[model samples]
Target: MDVTGKVAVVTGAGRGIGHGIAMKLAQNGAHVVVADIVEENAREIAREVESTGKTSMACFLDVTDRQSVESMGESVINQFGQIDILVNNAGVIGAAGWEKRETASEADWDITFLVNVKGIGTVTDTISPHMKERRYGKIVNIASVAARKGTATSTPYGASKAGVINFTQSTALELAPFNINVNAVCPGLLWTDMWERIAVRFRSKDDYPDELTPREVFDRFVKARTPLGREQTPEDIGNATVFLASDAAENITGQALNICGGYMMN
Candidate 1:
């Protein structure tokens, strides 16, 4: 687990799981590049990393835009010399609560695919050249359980994540000869901003126990579904990320690891 001097680029690392991953990598002595669409949040995490006595840089990145992703990669290369790890953690929960595929408009599908699926392609493609040249890299993609288990109202999100898993497999196969390991981490519901938004959908309409906040309700749902009897946290995801990014997982690639507390046994 010693990652001293290793450079890591974590996308959408402003808050939640991405932020936790970046912080954990930094804590482990990696020179972390925190990339986010929100520049301010990225800078905030960079500051936090510095406070922890580690090297970090904040970059404004739009993973869906090829130019932006390339420019961010350039910036990291200029500052850090090389990229050793890339974490595709930036994603969206496209059209939450609208289960009916027939009800989802064309625009909804486009936006979801652009950000969740194509964005991953853009960033990974931009960084692949660098990784290939180095002949060593570790890639960790953030997929979701919805990708494996199709959920109601999750068509766009699920489809995009399923794409991520396949993309990881394909990319891993291609990068293996170059000594790069590509894998994915599938996370179940954690207490992130996305969940907060999802919670709102049930707030006014659903009749539940009076003692529960929307978050508590969501927690109860997970506890009932997950055999682990508890909800996941950003830290749980982060720890898995750090391990996957480290040499400890060097032999593991093209595989999707579920951090769902056995919510979906496969």
Candidate 2:
């Protein structure tokens, strides 16, 4: 597939890693559909894409909503004439204490599955028909290292991401016949608003020990954990996604590439 002339849909493109991926794709000459639950951020992202001289459309999308996912898919097809790439990047961090197992509620579990796992399933399924018609597609699901091991206290998040990995493999097998490559990118610690929030949640508000802000602390944590001695930036994940979406990764399907700065070598 020639990415330069292709149309790509990216969920959660409001900010952070999703925004980074959208920007990279646009920079590489792909028309982008920046979908996000956060309306303002989504618009901002769309504008940013356009600023780079690429076509971009912003849409309010709640991935967990079947209607929303289907609508967005239709919009992409209507606007661009065909769908070439789909990036499932929208997800949520379950309410605090969701990983306590016994304390985790059914509602929390359902939300995690709904947004983190099923959301991707919904979007991909809706777009599959278009890809099948064209006999070409590239899907990059944003998973996390949490799926590979036990998160400190984010079990639901971890489990949902694990589901993402398994689902990616399953989808790849099903889509390969149509020449679509379905894969997942499991990002490790990074400097993003989500990471800052997680850091704040882990630290005591009064005495967090570190003098750094929550975002800084999150970066420090990644540096401490990874052999690379630094956190993986959104740009890092963006580059990986571009490679996966390009013909360079045509032979790479049903795979989960860890962009975790060597944090998880397996």
TM-score of model 1 vs. true structure: 0.93
Give me candidate 2's TM-score against the actual structure: 0.93
In order, the Cα lDDT scores of the candidates are 0.86, 0.87
**lDDT tens readout by residue for model 1, 145-164:** 88887875357778889999
TM-score of each: 0.93, 0.93
- Runs of candidate 2 with Cα error greater than 4 angstroms are 96-103, 205-212
Question: Candidate 2 on 1-266: residue-level lDDT in tens?
Answer: 24797899999999999999999999988999999999899999999999999999999999889998888888888888999999999887775554233445777788888999989999999998999999999999999999998866467789999999999999999999999999999998887777766776656534355466776667667767899887888888988999999998999999999999799987
lDDT of 2: 0.87
